[model samples]
Target: MLEKTGVPTPEQVKRAAPTEDRLKKGPVAVVECFQSIPCDPCQYACNQGAIKEFVDINDVPIIDHEECNGCGICISQCPGLAIFVIDATYSEDKGLVKVPHEYTPLPEKGEVVTGLDMAGNEACDAEVVKVQSAKSLDRTPVVWLAVPHDCLMKVRGFRRKGGAE
Candidate 1:
């Protein structure tokens, strides 16, 4: 349930899912996040010291897969609900997209959730595979969605259709 406003497209997700071979040989690279409000947890979460040394805390997170373990520690640390993890290397059937899911009545694994884009509009349908959270994540659940190969670049977020916050 994206907003009645600017919704993202699957093509955007595709364009956004560009590959970085360096991540495969080393740590995972994080991208596709455009919003800069209320975030910067990635700096403190990176135990390897890859993020802090590379940029300022106020700056956006620039992950160096060379040191990233894809541990997803930073995925939950975000506050604006921005940021995600994408693995285009996954099988042809689908790929992994880790998002900061912070809505009530969160969808369950295997449940078909509504895929949304940056503007908070419907883009496609995706399946929820993993939903994780810890006290450190600040109540934000790191939702892993199994999205169609085509939806990779378009589906930036999720929408539950109708509900109250």
Candidate 2:
């Protein structure tokens, strides 16, 4: 039911998808915010003002992808966990994706885990490249995964070896 109607279609993602060059430059914020809610934390969280403030709280957040250095400060700031930092230049054959992980038993660095797509489906096996859980993050851990270059845009999150926590 979700995939058929609830989840975004490929065409939609393609329309808003960042270019390969942009992804390769450095880390960029990929805001998957599709709904309108009273939220402006993303704009305030970014010290660079990469994310524009909404005149109306219900307006969706607007990000100047070019201005985003992909620092990932907004990742944890977003209460909805709708932000992702994609670094296509992580390696020649690998890309790094930073996702917000709120589940317990957080995966450690260098751990091999199942990468999940936007629809929460296993997309590939990825290695945990980095795990940041600073106090400023307020318990929201940012998990970075080293996934195949081709899956840079596809991989969104990760699951532990045994199963999802």
Candidate 3:
């Protein structure tokens, strides 16, 4: 049920990965759903219809990555917190990532925090670019972080200052 390192397997990543061409178009959502759970919020959250409607409630989502504009809507709508928005074109030296955050003491905009990877390993320092908590989000805060361009793909989330959750 897990990859060699006890996380998502290579096949799972491949299934959820967007095409390199789509990624080059700018920021896009990456749905990391490896299991076929009965979920579809991501599909409807995408105003562009980039996430296809599931034939069955239990079916996994398929991304039309080209249609994705990286609006970061699906990031807060996903119940599994599996959707990530990556923008490699944010700048020449930085990248942007929008991640779902449910923890307390949410980092403020412009604040610096430690970035962590999927396995909770420290990746790099990240700056909070924006914090979206619109009423439509239903309590799930979507945090946007600016990280080093080189660590863009490696960063999955952020940690509070002083190693706090």
Could you say which candidate leads in lDDT? 2
Where is the poorest 10-residue window by lDDT in model 2? 1-10
lDDT for residue 46 in candidate 3, whole number 0-100 = 88
Q: Give candidate 2 regions above 4 Å deviation.
A: 1-5
Give the TM-score comparing model 3 with the true structure, all chains together: 0.91
Tens digits of per-residue lDDT for model 3, 16-117: 766767766799998888777787888888899999988999988888888899998888889999999989888888989889999988888999999998
- What's the lDDT for all of these models? 0.63, 0.86, 0.85
**Tens digit of per-residue lDDT, candidate 2, span 16-118:** 5678778868889888877778888888899988888779988898888888999999999999898898898888889898999999888888999999887
Pairs in clash, predicted candidate 1 = 1-159, 3-120, 9-154, 10-154, 12-153, 13-152, 13-153, 13-154, 14-153, 27-65
The candidate with the higher lDDT, 1 or 2, is 2
Best by TM-score: 2
TM-score of 2: 0.93
Any runs in candidate 1 off by more than 4 Å, and if so which? Answer: 1-29, 32-40, 54-56, 161-165
In angstroms, give how far residue 49 of model 1 lies from its true place: 3.3
